[model samples]
Target: MGELVARSLIALLFVLNGAATARDPEPRRAKAAWFGNPPLLAVRANGAAMVVLGLLLVTGWQRTWVASGLGVLLVLTTIGGHAFWRAADRAERGRELTQLVKNTAVLGGLLLLAMP
Candidate 1:
């Protein structure tokens, strides 16, 4: 029951995130710069993929694979989007640190979803 709830909530989170990223990509574009700043189009594509994958996850198709892959993505973006060590503003640094920790927690939840 908790697993089902977690899966649903995580899917909803991805849905909202993907939609926001697709709609307002500037924020994501800025953070994604660390990895050579791929084209904005690529970022948009990633958001779209997330939406699709999130839908698949909600339906329980390949749950373990999807959860694991999403967990990996969460880890990567947690680093990419919130490397507090590189932040200039103290508040920004703290915010980023919080985001990183929150992402880590979500990643743990995803890992749980991956388990049988």
Candidate 2:
């Protein structure tokens, strides 16, 4: 029961975030401009993958594969979105660093879930 609840909560975060990204790639596009301005299609594709994998995770289907996929997706996202070192201002750097740490924890959780 606890595992199910944890999976559900985590899945919900990814699913909702993915849906939002898929629905509006423009914001992500602008934010990721430093990363060479990934195309809207690419952004949407990533989001779609997240949604599909997150759903699979919560459904207890192919848990290992889904968790691995999500972990990869999260790594990419953290690199592109939470590049704290790139922040020019102190406050901005702090904010980005916080995000990076949060994502790192989430990634750790996903990795644990991936194991048999």
Best by TM-score: 2
Q: Candidate 1: which pairs clash?
A: none
lDDT of 2 by residue, 41-78 (tens): 99999899899999988987888888889999989988
Per-prediction TM-score to the true structure, in the order listed = 0.90, 0.94
Model 2 segments beyond 4 Å from truth? none
Candidate 1 TM-score to native: 0.90
Candidate 1: C-alpha lDDT: 0.80
Lowest lDDT sum, 10 consecutive residues, model 2, at 28-37
Model 1 misplacement above 4 A: none
Cα lDDT computed for each candidate against the true fold: 0.80, 0.88
